[model samples]
Target chain A: MTSASKSLTAETLIVQEVAPRDGLQIEPVFVPTEAKIALVDALSAAGFTRIEVSSFVSPKAVPALRDAAEVFAGIARRPGTVYVALVPNLKGAERALAAGADEINLVMSASETHNRANMGMSCEASLEAFGHMVAAARGTRATINATIATAFGCPFEGPQAVEKVEALVARYGDLGVDGVTLADTTGMANPRQVADLVRRTLARVPAERLTLHVHNTRGAGIANVLAAHGAGARRFDAALGGLGGCPFAPGATGNVCTEDLVSLCHEMGLETGLDLAALIGLARGLPALVGHEVPGQVAKAGRPCDLHPAPARKAA
Target chain B: MTSASKSLTAETLIVQEVAPRDGLQIEPVFVPTEAKIALVDALSAAGFTRIEVSSFVSPKAVPALRDAAEVFAGIARRPGTVYVALVPNLKGAERALAAGADEINLVMSASETHNRANMGMSCEASLEAFGHMVAAARGTRATINATIATAFGCPFEGPQAVEKVEALVARYGDLGVDGVTLADTTGMANPRQVADLVRRTLARVPAERLTLHVHNTRGAGIANVLAAHGAGARRFDAALGGLGGCPFAPGATGNVCTEDLVSLCHEMGLETGLDLAALIGLARGLPALVGHEVPGQVAKAGRPCDLHPAPARKAA
Candidate 1:
C-alpha cells in the first residue's frame, strides 16, 4: 500500500439504453419518426448493445409512439445490437413482430386494480395473455421478457404481496421465457423488500433470466434496483431523462434515468459500454425533441465533476 | 406459502436525518429559527436518533441558516438523541460550541476547485483547521466527524480521484476525528463507484468510523447508499424532504430523502428505529416551508407494500 491506493473494488455494470422508447413516451410532442431513428442510430453508434426503440401499443393509446413501426424500420441497425419493443397485448406483440423488433417486452401489474386500470384487464387475463404471447413468439428470433409491474408497491392496490410476484415468476420460469423483469411501477419498493424479492425471484429464476424495471415514482426506483442487484439481478430497464410512468399514475415520474444508471454502473467499475459525454449530448437534445424539460441531471449539468462558473457574470 | 412470506430481509436501517442543516442551506427563504426548532422537536418525537439540527456558517454565505444558535437552543432535546451542527471554520466552531451542539460536523470539498469556491479555502487549510478544532474540542464532550464533500465527483472538477478521497480520510484519521463521511454533494456517484469507494475507504478507515452522506442530485443517491452498505457501511446522512441543493449548481436536487432512505434500509433487514410514516409526514409538510415542492417520492407517494390509500382518498 503505497499510501495512495484506496479503492476497495472495481465492479462493472451494464446499462441498457431506453431513451428511444421510454424517454420519448411522456413527451407532449410526437417526435418525427426520422428523429427517433436518428436518436437510435446515435445511441447505437455510442456503443449501446441494447436499446429499446419503440412500443407496440395502439397508436391512439400512446400517440407519441404512433409511428413506432416507421421509427423502427427507419433506424440503421448495427450488427451486434438488440432492439427491444414494449408490447401491451397480442396486438402489440403482432405489431412488434411486424416492425422487426429484436426483443419483445410484456408487462403485467402485480396489483389487480392497477392491472385493470393500466391495461384495462384483470391480472388473470394479463397472465393468460402473457402465456399466449409467449407461445406465439416461441419460434421467432426475438427474445421475450416479462415485466411484473408494481412488484415493489402500488398506489391503487397498496404494497404488492411477495407471493403474487413469486407466482408470476414461477409462471414465467415455467414458460421457458428468455427473462423476467420486476418493476416498482409506482416506486413503492424499499431496499429490503427489493433485495428479498429479487433474491427469491432469482432463486426461482436464474440471475441471467431476471431484470429489474423500476420507476422513480416514490424515489426508490434506483434503490430498489440496487437491492435487486444485491439480491442478484444483472439486467435492468431504464429510461433516459427518467421519462415514462404508468398512464394510470399521472403524476408519477417515469422509469429510472438511463444516464444516471449508466453513471452508477460505470463508476462502480461495471462494464456498461456507454459514453458519458455522448449520453449527456443525447440527453440534452431530448428536451427539444419532447417539447418539455427532461428530468435527466447529467445532461443539464454535464458529469458531476464538470464544474465551470457561468460566463454571464464574467465580462471583466 | 402465504402472500407476505416472500418479502425478504426484515428489520430497519438506522436513517440518520440531516434535513434541518443540509436541506435548508440552498434555499433563498430564511426559514424562521423557531420553525427549525419545531421541525427538530417533531423529528425527535417522530423517532430520529440522530438529527443534524443546524450549521454554524457565516450568515453572508448561507443566509438560510443564519439562526443556527436559536434553532439549536429552541429544539426540545431528547435524552438519547444526538443533535449535530455543521461548522465551517473557527468562528462557526465557536458558535457551535456555545450552542451546546452534541456533535460538530466539519465539511470540506474533496476537489480543490470546489473547496475554493464553496468554502474559500484549500483542502490543506481545511484539514489544518479540522486538526485545530479537534484539539480545541478535546475537553468538550462532543463527537467530531469530517465529511469529504464531492467525494464521488465534483461540479467544478469532473471525476474525483479515489486517491484524493483516501488522502483526506487518512488526514481525518490522523486528526483523531470520530468518523469520515463520504458526501456525493452533487449526486454524481453510481452504485459501483460507491461500493468500490466504500471498500477502499474501509481499509483505511474502520466501518464504525465511516458514514455516507449522499445527495440524490442525479437520482443515484439512494442506489449509491445501498451500494455502500453492501460494501459494509452503516451510517447514512439524509434530509427529510429531499429538499435544497447548491445554489451555485442550478437543477441539482438536495440530499437523499429520509423517509425513502429509512424505508429502503428497513426493507433490507437493517436496524434503524425510525417510523416510515412519520418521516413521510415531515417530508409532506416541507413544500410550504420552502415555497416549492421538495423532491422526495415516498413522502408524497407512499412506500412499497403500503396498500392503504389515505382515508380521505378512500372516501373520495
Candidate 2:
C-alpha cells in the first residue's frame, strides 16, 4: 500500500523540509503565520515531497509556533506533498489531525529525565500514549510516526544506552506506527555511536520505517548522518537553515542544516533528489525572518567548488 | 634526540597554537608587541605547550605582526613550551633562528596556483628551498616542520588530488622534517574525503609524522579531523577561536577553532592535552586585539551540556 513512496529509484531522494515547525519554534522572533505559509508554499514548489509543517505543543512551551492551526490552513500544499505535524501528546495528536495534518509525529525522549522534562511524561506513559495515538489515528490517511528523542545523548543523562533506545523502537514498531525516528537532540553523539545505534535499530525496524534526525551542535551532525547511512538507514529529518532545537534543552542549537546535509549527500553520489541551489536559496531566506544568523554555513557561503574568478580586475 | 617528541603520542593530540603567527597576520589593526607578548605568555601559562609565537614573513604583507621580533623577545617562555616561528624564506628563517625560536615552520601550498598566490613560489621551488632549510636546521635544536597548504582543497583547483598530497607527504618525509602538516586551505573537505585521504596517506607515511591543519570555512573542519583520526593520522595544527585565513583567498574564514576541536576530541576519549577552558579564555581575549568576534562558538556559548539556571525572578 505504501507503493515505495512513488518510484524513488536509487537516484532519487526526498527532502523533508521542517523549517516552519522546527525552525520557527526555537527561533527568538515569532514568524507571522502568513510568512510561515508563504515559506511552506515556496518550499512545496521547490520539489519537497514531505514538509513537517508545525508542532502541536502548548503555546506556553513553544510560543513561536502558536499559529499552528492558521499556518496549516494557510499553505498552498502541492498534491503529492505529505504535510507532517509534530504531536507531543494525545491532545496534540487530536489537534493536528483536526487541523488537516496529513501525518502526525509523536516524540518522547529515550532518557528518563528528558522524557519527563521535554515531554512531561514518563517513558512508560509516553509508550502507553503512543498506543492511544495509534488507535486515535486509525482508519485515517494521517500516518503516525514515533520519534525516540535523545536516543544518541540526553541533556540530563549523558550517553544513552543503545538497548533502551532499541526497546523504545520495538515498542513503537509493535504499536502499528508507520515509522520511527531516532533523534540526536543534543549534538553529543559521535559517528561511531550513530553507526552503532542505526545499524542495530535497522535490524528490528526496517529502513523504510526508520528516520534519523540529527543536530549539528558539536559539528558532527552531517558526519553522523552519513555514518548512519553507511550503516544502512537512509531516511533523514532536517530543518532548512538548521532551524530547530528543543528550547527546554539549553545550549542545544537548531537541527542539522538541511542544505549542508543535502550538499554533502549529493556530492558523495547519494541521490537525495534535491535541487541543491534551490534548497540553499530557501535557507538564505531564513535568517531575516528569524532575526538571527541561521547556522547553515552553505546558505551564507556557496558550495566549496563554487569559485568565481576575481571578476576581471577592470582597468587594472 | 627525537625520543621526547615521539613520546608525545601522535594519536594523543598536541595542538600547535597558530594564533600568534597565522591568526594575527591578516588583521588591519596593529596589535601592540607588548599585548602580543602578553597573549603568548598567558597561553603558555595556560598549558599550550606548543605555540607559534610569531611570523618571520615580510613585514609589508602583514603589518599587524611586523613586531614579531619584539613580541618574541618580550614573551616569558615557560618551561616545556616550544615557541615556533613561520619563516617564508632563508632571510626569515635566519631571523627566526636568531630570535631563539625553538622550532621553525615553512609552508608551501599543494596547489600550484595557491603556492604562487600565497608564497610567490612554485611547488618545486618551495620543496627545493625547504630541503635547504631542513639541512640548515640540522646543526641546531631548532626543528624544521614543513606545511602543505591546501592539501585537502584549494581555491583555484577545486579538489586536491590525493595522489599529489601523498607524493608531497613522501617528499617531505624524505626531507627529514619533523612533521608534514596537511592543510585544508579552504574548507572544501567533508568527513568521507578526510577519511579516504588520511587512510591512503597513513599507509605510505607514518601517522605520527602527519598533521592536519584545517579551516572552518564550510563547517566540516572538526568533522574532517575526527575522520582523519579514525583513519589513523593524529597530529593537528590549529589556531585558537578559528582565527587565521589565507589573506589572498577571497571570503575564507580563519583556521579550525582550537577549543571546539579540543572539546570534541577530549569528550571522545581521545586525549588532546590542551585545556579547553583555558583555550576559550585566550580566544575570548582575542576580540579586543583583532577588532571583531573571533568565530569560536565555545567562547561565547560554552561547551555542550554547560547549564546555567535562570536567575531567580526578582519579586515583581
Candidate 3:
C-alpha cells in the first residue's frame, strides 16, 4: 500500500452533524420542536463531537426552523458535544449567543451572484457585516466560524475560482473567526478540485479549524470527502439521511449522509468515535420524520459487516 | 496539491458501460430487444469504448436479458468500440463468440459461500471451469477476461482478505486471461481498501488489464473509483442511470452511475473520452425504461458546468 493510504487508516475524522440546521432548514414541513431536540439529542448520543442544532434565521424566511430557539432550549446538550447554531447577521448572532450556543456558524456565498441571492448583499457587504458580528461577540463564549457557501461552484455563476475562496478564508481570519467551512452548496465539487482546494486552504488555515461541507447532488460528495481527507482535511459536516437540498438548484439533492460517511470512515479504519448502528437507526427513522424516503444508502442497505443469510440454493 | 491528485488530472480512465448487461439483469420487466440494441448503440455513439451488451446465461434464469442473442445481433457495431458479452461457461462462451461478441467476460465470486450460492460451485470448481472456457477461446478472435465478484466483501461471507483476492488474480493470470475485474458486488468497498487492493492487484496485473467494478450500495462507489484510479487501475465498470441490484444482497443499489462518473472524471481533468451530455440524455431516459426512478445523480441534477439562470431577486 502507498504511504497515503496507510496513513488514512490511522487518522481520526471529526464529524459535525448538520441535519438539524442544514437539513431541516430546507424541509417543506416543520418538524415539532420536541422532535428537533430529540434528533439533536440522538445525534449527540451517537457520539458526534459537534452538532449544528438550529439556525437563528427569520421565522418568515424559514418557517421550517421557526422553532429553532425552542428546539435549542429543549435539547439535552452532551458535555463534549459542541452545540452550534447558524447565524445570518449580528441580530442572529446575538440571539444564538443569548441562547447559550457553544458555537455560532455564519454563512456567506463565495460567488457574488449567490451572495446577493442568498443573503441580499454583495460579498463585500457580507464580509463587512460579519466583521460587526465578530466584534459584537468578542467577549462571548461562542466560538465564531463562517461557512463560505458555493465555495466549489454556484448554480447561477457556475464553477468558482479557488483564489476567490482563499480570499474569503483570509477575510474570515482577519475578522478573528474561530474556524471556516467550505460548503459545496450546489454539489459542484470534483475530487481533484477538492484535493487542490483543501491543500491550498490548509496552507492558510490549520487542519483542525477547516471543515468540508458537501452535497451529494451529482454523487461526488463522498469522493470529495475522501479527496479532502487524503489532502489532510480532518473535519467534515454531514446530515442525517442526507436530508437537505439547495433551494436555488431545483433538482439538487441533500448533504452527504452522516451514517454513510461514518460507515465509510469505520470501514477505512479511520476513527470517527461514532456508533454506526446508532447512526443507521437514526437514519432509518428519518423517512418518517421527513415524510419521505431519504437518499442515504447505509440506512437502506445495511453496513458491509452486517452479513445476510445464505440463500437456500443458487439465487444470483 | 498532493502529487497523487496532480497525476490524477493527467490520467485517462477507461469506462466499460455495463447497463445493458448488469443493469438489465435485475429489472423485473424485460426491455425490448430493439431497445436493448438501441441502448448499446447509443452508448457506443456516446464514446464508450467498451460495452457489455448482454449475458449469455439461461433464459429462465434472467428473463430480462432473455433476448441476449437478438440484442447482440441487432446492435450497430462501432469500429472502435468493443462489444462484450458476459458468459458463464464454455457453452455461453461459444454462444457469445458465435454471436460475434468482441470480448467475453466471465464471473465468479471470491468467497466460497458466494461462489456456491452464486454459481452453484466451489471456488475451485469455478476456476477449473473457467480454465476450460479459457482453453476453448484460446484461438478465437474474442478477448477473454474474468471478474472476481465479492472481491472486496461478500454479503454472506463479509469482508474478503486481500490475499484471497490476490490469489484469484494470480490464478486468472495462470489461466492466461486478457484482463481481470475486481467486482464489489454489494458496494462494500471503502477507499483505503480500494487503494490497498488496487496497489496489490496491479503488482500481479498490468494497469490496462485491470478493471474495478463497484456498486453504490453504501454511497461509496465514486470514492472507491477515485481510490482505485489513484492507485493505478485504469478501467472501471459503471451502469447507465445506476440501474441494477444484487439479488442476494437486498436493497443494494446498482453499479456506479455512468454519467456521474464521467462528469467527475471530466471535472477532475481526467480523460474519459465519453460525452457527458450524451450519457445524461441516456440516463434521463432510464426511468421510463425501467418503470421507476433511477439512482443516478447527474441525470437529475445536470452537470456541474450546466449552469442555471440566476433568480430574479433574493430567493435563498
Per-residue CA lDDT of model 1 for A117-175, tens digit only, reads: 77887788888898889887878888888888878776776767899889988887777
Residue by residue across A1-316, what tens digits does model 2's lDDT show? Answer: 2333556444444557788887787777889888999999988887777889999988987899889999898889788778999998888999999999988999888987777776666789888988888898988879988898889877666778888888888888789999888988877777777889988998997776778888876556776777777787767888888787655444445788788878766655677767789888888888778876667767666787776453222120
Tell me the tens digit of each residue's lDDT in model 1 across B185-253. Answer: 878788778889999998987665678988877777777777787787767888888876765557767
Residue range B182-252, candidate 2, lDDT tens digits: 77877777777888988887776676666788777766677777778777776777888778765444344
Clashing pairs in 3: none
Q: Which model scores highest in TM-score?
A: 3
Please give each candidate's TM-score: 0.85, 0.89, 0.96
Write model 3 residue lDDT over A138-171, tens digit each, in one string: 8987788899999999999988888989999999
Candidate 2 residue runs with Cα over 4 Å from true position? A1-15, A245-252, A310-316, B1-11, B78-81, B245-253, B304-316
Give residue B84's lDDT in candidate 1 (0 to 100): 87
Clash count list over all predictions: 28, 1, 0
TM-score of chain A of each: 0.89, 0.93, 0.95
lDDT for position B6 in model 2? 59
Q: Distance (Å) between predicted and true CA of A181, model 1?
A: 3.1
- Model 3 interface CAPRI class: medium
Number of the predicted model whose lDDT against the real structure is largest: 3
